[model samples]
Structure formats: structure tokens, C-alpha cells
Target: MILHTNDVFKVTRPEDIFETRGRFAYFRVELLSQKGNIDVSLKLTGRLDWTFTRSITLTRKTNDKGVAVFPVGRICESLIQGTKSNLITYVITASEYDHAGPALYAVPGFADREILPEWGDGENISQFYPAAPCIVVYPNAGFEQSLFFPKQTGELFVLTPSSTTTEKYIGNSAFSPIIPFDPAKIPSEDLGKPLAVGATPTDYNAEIRTYYDYCTKGIFLKWTDAAGIPYLYRWTQESKTDEMSVESTYHQLDDTLTPRDVQNKTLAKRYTLHSRIVERDVFNLCRTILGCQDLFMYDPDVGNWVRFMVEDSESEDTGAPMQDLVVEIVRYEYL
Candidate 1:
């Protein structure tokens, strides 16, 4: 559970388990002797079809408190390649003497978002589910279907109205579904409109994500977490105003009324989005939209993801659910 780089040896350490010995209950026997200056080592071995193949071992001498300091999160992070999401499964073995402790199974994902995958009581799937249930995708964007959905054991199928394709997981490392959706299969009129596609292991549901996508139509904004998982949500109230800011001004010109530098003029788009957000989506918007590394709006007119940003704290106005439920996006463009 404790997977932070500096959190090791402080919060999460080996449990001191003791057993009873002798006929007298006063005498207690410990499974492992927790003595200072003792030799201790941690061995981490990957699970079935894991991405990381090499085994990791770290040896340390116990301190005065019989504590062996080992940073599990830091150790696992060193093996990660690139900035992509990595789903890892491994067993942790602690050794003090000749006897090896019980194998502790851990499934941790190091990605853009800080999603802690807890061990469910009857969890059978080897893969981890995204923190959010849905994603806001570009009409023709490509994404691995398995990354968004729980890895289903059966023959997974990705189907459209006009076609069907399949992927599997029993013997495969990961299954990726073709997501550059077909324009022909979709209604010509609805081709670029907002379509919330939901998924199951077998195939995609023929239904939309929310009922509002029908009645309360709006634009969807997208942002990714630290783990690189993207989240898209809809906001109906959209407005834009172009404000020109002059970096430098020169003498008065005939074409311009005021003394202005037309060549140095920059068009800053003051785009505003107003929407009544429900209780659940309020949190998702704050974390994903408010301080996102990159922000985009799905322009219904153009049917594309337009880059924009929430101007600043002042852009937000008081709203029922959250302060910034209504926000104006600002983007600067060279004229």
C-alpha cells in the first residue's frame, strides 16, 4: 500500500510476527529474530508475462531497531522505461536467515496518474483498471482498448455498427483494439458529433456514455494525469471573445485609429465554458481540467480537439458544486 519513494522504511516495513513457545504461555517465540546488525535481503520476482523480466535483490543490515530499510517504490521505478504507463506484477520475498518469509503478491502500476491498485478480495484479473470509467477521445485518435477497460478473460471483441474485430488475453501480453473509428459505419450526420463510447470486454456497447449527450449537448474538455491517463468531460456553456494585445506601439498610422503596432498585435482568445456540474464530475474536472499540463476542447463546429486553457484563478466564478464549475478558457494565437 505504501509505494512512495521516501515512504519506505517509515510507514511500510516488515511485520513483527511472533509465535508462542513452551508449555508456559509467558515465553513467546518469534518466527524470525529481529536483531540489530542482522543480514536482511529483499527479492522481487515478476509474475506471469510481466514486462520486467530481471529479478531484483537488495541487501541491507538491520539497524538498532531491527529495521531493514528498503525503498520498494524507488527500486521498481528504476526498471521503468520511458514515461508510458507500466502495469507490473511481482512477488516480494524477505530473508533474514535461511528461512524465506511468505511470498507477498503485489500489483502496482507506475504511470502518469497516482492510482494505487489495491488488492481486491477475489481479484482474478492481472491488469489494472483506469481510475475513471470513461475517456474523452478524438474522433479518430488511436488508443489501446485494454488500457481503458478491464482485461477480460474471454475472446475480446471490438465491434462497430458495420464491423467486428477480436483480441485475446489468455496467452498474450496485452491486447490492443483498433480505435481509429470508421467514418463510413457511423451516421454521416453524426460523424463529428460528440459520441460517448462505452466498452465491455467482449465489445463496445451500442449505447452512449450519458443521457446528457442527447439532451444537454456541450463541448468536451480533455486533460491527462501524471500517469498519462487522459480524462474527457463535457461542458455546455461555451463562448469566445478575441482580445488584441499590443506588445509595442509606434507612431499613429492611417489604417489604425490609435497609435498601435499592428505587426506586433497578438490575438488572445478569451473562451468561456459554463455548465452545471453534478457532484461526481466536479472532482474529475478540478483535478484534470483545472491544472492540466495540456487542455483541449472538442470544437463541435470543426469536429476536432482545439488546444485551450483555463486562464487563471480569476477565470472561475462562484458555482453551486464548485467555485470554477464555470470557467473561461484563454488561448493566444499569432494573428
Candidate 2:
């Protein structure tokens, strides 16, 4: 009997050629013999490692169409475990009538990305929400709340909650309570305002306008996705701030300064992300999501946006068995 493989059977998915996990490798063979009931045996052999090799054999009679299809799925998962190398040299051979010598077909499989846990809709690991510009207020003993801010800078009128307030603590450091002021209390009398070097009382208005510009100049951070779409979030010091306190002792004669203690502190920003990946798109995540590291992000404490990388990720199953994949990501980052 004469046998050959079809061109369609040789074509493979790109991921299957690279990463075999979560995919199947298939091949078809056709026999040219006219006789029926001819017994044939198919054999597949491959190296699992330098010290061991594995082989599987299946025997059957060719169909009326003279075609036999082999679906080898997840076999790589078992053979590839605990192996240092991802490269596997394999051969598929067949014999007819139990006396025909083995016909040899050789191929090589290269392992690409490491296999991750199976993705399911219920396995989504992140939950994301659209964030807005606001001050997240956390009192010493009460639930946290948010204060909205306009994009423009202006005199801020602070509001105090009716309940008694205490200092807020981050780590071991304490932050003073936000001072509340009434909008009507803004001083209009310019008695304490500074004057320009050579300006008389009539020119105070111009000097005040120049000073306002200097005080308002500050840098703001901007965050964007891998596609360069900007995030709708902003930060402010009132919501969070970094503080450093140092204490030093000085010697008399040499005027040498000795350090006693120092404390550094800052509050971090966190985000919850919710997303989905269909079965067809799951294999491409390495390139589209995890691979892009230069994306922009917003910081709530700084009142500006800045560039950030995904520092950590966590996932969970979000669907029933054998369903599409969904993931929720709780992302953590630093400025």
C-alpha cells in the first residue's frame, strides 16, 4: 500500500507551532490501496528528555475514503513536564498488513510560552471601574469618602464633616486633619498681601496677578492604555501626600550633626480591573496586554497623571467548566 499526507493536514495554527498548551496538533494520512479490510498501525514517538523517550501506537482499518485522521491533543502537556528544554524531536510512522516495513515521517516541535492555567469565563481575576478626579478622604476613625475637584486651579473652600475628626495614619506616620474654611471667609482686604519691588499701592493688583501664576505652576501626571487612550483619573495632594520627618542632634565643639530618627511615608493608589478574553483571543494576551509596559496611568494623590507599569496581577475563575474566559485584575503600582 502507498500512503501520503495532504497539504491541508500539514498546515498548523501559529500558536500550536509555538505554544502547544491549550491547543491540538492534527495530521491526516491517505492510503492508495484498492483492497478493503487492510489492517494498519500508526505509531508516534518523541523524546521527553535526554534520558527518556515516549511512544504511542494506534491500530485500525482504513475507511472507505482511504483517509485516517489523527488528533493529538494535550499529549505535549504530559511529556513536557519537568523537562528543561522545550524542543522535542518527533516521528510518526505507519505499517500496513503487519508485514510492511515502517514508513517514516519526521517533525520537530518547539515549545514557546510556558503554559498558564486554563482560562474560563468564571476565572476572570480583575474588576475595573471608571475613575474620576477626586480627593479620597480617610478620617482617623470613619469610613473613607471622596471630594470632587474641577480640573482648573482656584481658591479651595474646605468642608468639614459634622463628626469629630482625628489624625489619619498611613503605616506608622500620622497626618493632620484637613482644615475647613468657609467660602465667605476669603480675605478681600489686601492688607497682608506683598507688593512688587518698585510698585506703589496703585500697582498691587499687577503684582498679585504675577504671584498667582508662580504659585499655580505645577506638573500633572497623565495615564493612558496600551492603545494610547487616556485614563479619566486625576490626583491631588489633599487626597494623599508624601511626608518625611528627620530629627538630628548636634555636637558642640566640632559642630558635627548626628542622626537620631527619620520617617518616610506616602499613600498608594490602587485600581480594580474587569476584562474578558474570548477563546480565540486568549492566546494573544502575552503580546497585547502583558507585553506592553510603557502605558500611562493616573495618580490620585499627586493630582497629575504619570507613566506606570503593571506591578502585580491576580486572577480567578469566573465561569462554569468549559466556557469562555473572563479575568479580573487588581493592579498595584508605584509612582
State which candidate has the highest TM-score. Answer: 1
Q: Can you write out model 2's per-residue Cα lDDT over 173-257, one digit (the tens) per residue?
A: 0110111222122133322332111111121111111111112212222233232112221112222223333334343433356
Q: Candidate 1 — number of clashing residue pairs? A: 7
lDDT of 1 by residue, 117-232 (tens): 33221122222233343333333332122123333232233333322233211111222211223222334444433332224333344222221232325666766533334555
Per-residue error at 112 for model 2, in Å?
16
lDDT, residue 22, candidate 1: 11
Q: Clashing residue pairs in candidate 1, if any?
A: 111-227, 112-226, 112-227, 112-228, 113-226, 113-227, 237-274
Best by lDDT: 1
User: How many clashing pairs per prediction, in order?
Assistant: 7, 36
Candidate 1 CA-lDDT value: 0.41
